[model samples]
Target: MRAYLIAAVLLALAIPVRGQAYMTDSGRAEFDSRVPLHTFTGTSDVLVGRISLPDSTVDFYLDLETLDTGIGKRDKDMKKTLETDTYPFAEFFGKLVSPFDPAGGTQPAVVRGTFTIHGHSQALEVTGTLEPTDDGLRLQAAWELNLDDYEIKPPKLLVMKVDPVQQMRISALLLPESESGT
Candidate 1:
């Protein structure tokens, strides 16, 4: 009986203790770029992301081909300009800088991470809100990025060109990995 108890304690100690990990494959990411004469908006609903609760680590990625700007020609041009053929995906890996309480209501948080686009990576800090849901957590964030910083040249039309800076927004609902069904 003594040996059994000792073995049980050792087995329990060997078990890994980990925070809940949540993931979502249908998240959304959007970008808006406007000029005086033209306004361009692109959206991708194929974003995949994971968030580790308690630890406050998060990662997300979306295929460049998933972006739709409503115009075929414009989408093709943008894809070519971004060199999507070479860099297939845009990804972000970050950690929450502010303390998060999962049981608490919506809380403001800052996520510091690296944003990789078109084969270039840049350090970025984004302020967003985090809220607990029945499944897991919901995150909403908005930030601006400059095209020049990523070595992406602004696309031009006949008389107007897209703004050098673009507004980006992300909304994701992540369910616990165990409940994500894949």
Candidate 2:
């Protein structure tokens, strides 16, 4: 019993922390949208993701409610437009289109999979770079998203309209499940 307890404690303490962030909130996700004369970006630090080795599978999710555009009204309007109450998360699960040598330096990774948002799913292919870190792997990926494809109606700000086209990006440091403590 003591041995088991000590092992668990050691594993819990083995994980490294950057600043005050942990595996769950260490990642970043952002989206940029333009509407004629206006361009705004929404960002969140609560991106959660993982990359499976050997199989080369990648998965990530962001809580829609966590996104902030610096304006409170805009965030609420955006959530309403996204129907986030019904679908609170945007998620992607896909297999890497190419082989990645973990031993090598940073490499480009292509993934094709389904993206779900606003209760709708659409097929998408994205490209990103992956680099190995001492604690885990760091992955950064971006792709263009058509809100209409996800059945998201762009919100209107007074007389201004939000663009249906959104540019999305995510950067995450994914530790092994054992080290992640969850």
Candidate 3:
């Protein structure tokens, strides 16, 4: 199926590589959603990303099913809202527009890419900070997304309803594929 093929390709992208390639592990991704009465953030540690300096390529993805908002019932509702079965992953692939020196200190970075979720894709440009770490690089980025843009209908029941706009953020320490210890 298409889903399986996409998953395979994403997995391949996360493999170890040589020369100017940085891979992410132990990364975290979060989406903060607000309702009239409350706000909750669904988080996951299975975030995957790769940066190729030679090509200025930046790519990232996370399994939707891996996210947990802390409550079992709410988590179930979220999966249903996201239709994770049909679109199992959220992904971004784009080019880095700003300079990134792995040996340098923290610097502002910009990336332009297409963010895909719920089988919908939209062009986006995100600004973040990239810092050189003892072992590799650390990336901190945040962006706002509207569920309507992805054709995702916000869940609603009784007086509880989720906001259509979500605040998305990610933090990852990217290490050279060789240094990532696979």
Q: Compare the candidates by lDDT and give the number of the best one.
A: 3
Compute each candidate's TM-score over C-alphas: 0.88, 0.83, 0.88
lDDT of all predictions, in order shown? 0.88, 0.81, 0.89
Please list the residue runs of candidate 1 whose C-alpha ends up more than 4 Å from where it truly belongs after superposition: 1-19
List CA RMSD, all candidates. 2.9, 6.6, 8.8
Pairs of colliding residues, candidate 1: none
Residues 1-182, candidate 2: write the lDDT tens digits: 99999998877665432211224346899999897798999999998876666456667789999999999998998898888888999999888887787688889988988889888888889999977778777888899999878878775658677678899999988776667865
Worst 10 residues of 2 by lDDT: 15-24
Model 3: what TM-score? 0.88
In terms of TM-score, how similar is model 2 to the real structure?
0.83
lDDT per residue, candidate 3, 1-182, as tens digits? 99999998877765533546888857899999999889999999989999887688999999999999999888888888889999999999999999887778999999999999999999999999988788788999999999999999866778787789999999999998777875
Q: How do the residues 1-182 of candidate 1 rate in per-residue lDDT, one tens digit apiece?
A: 99999999877754422337788999999999887877878999989998876567889999989999999988998899999999999999999888888799999989999999989999999999999888788989999989889999856766667788999999998888878874
**Of candidates 3 and 2, the better by lDDT:** 3
Clashing pairs in 2: none
Cα shift from native, residue 116, model 1 (Å):
0.5
Comparing 1 and 2 by TM-score, which wins?
1
RMSD of 3: 8.8
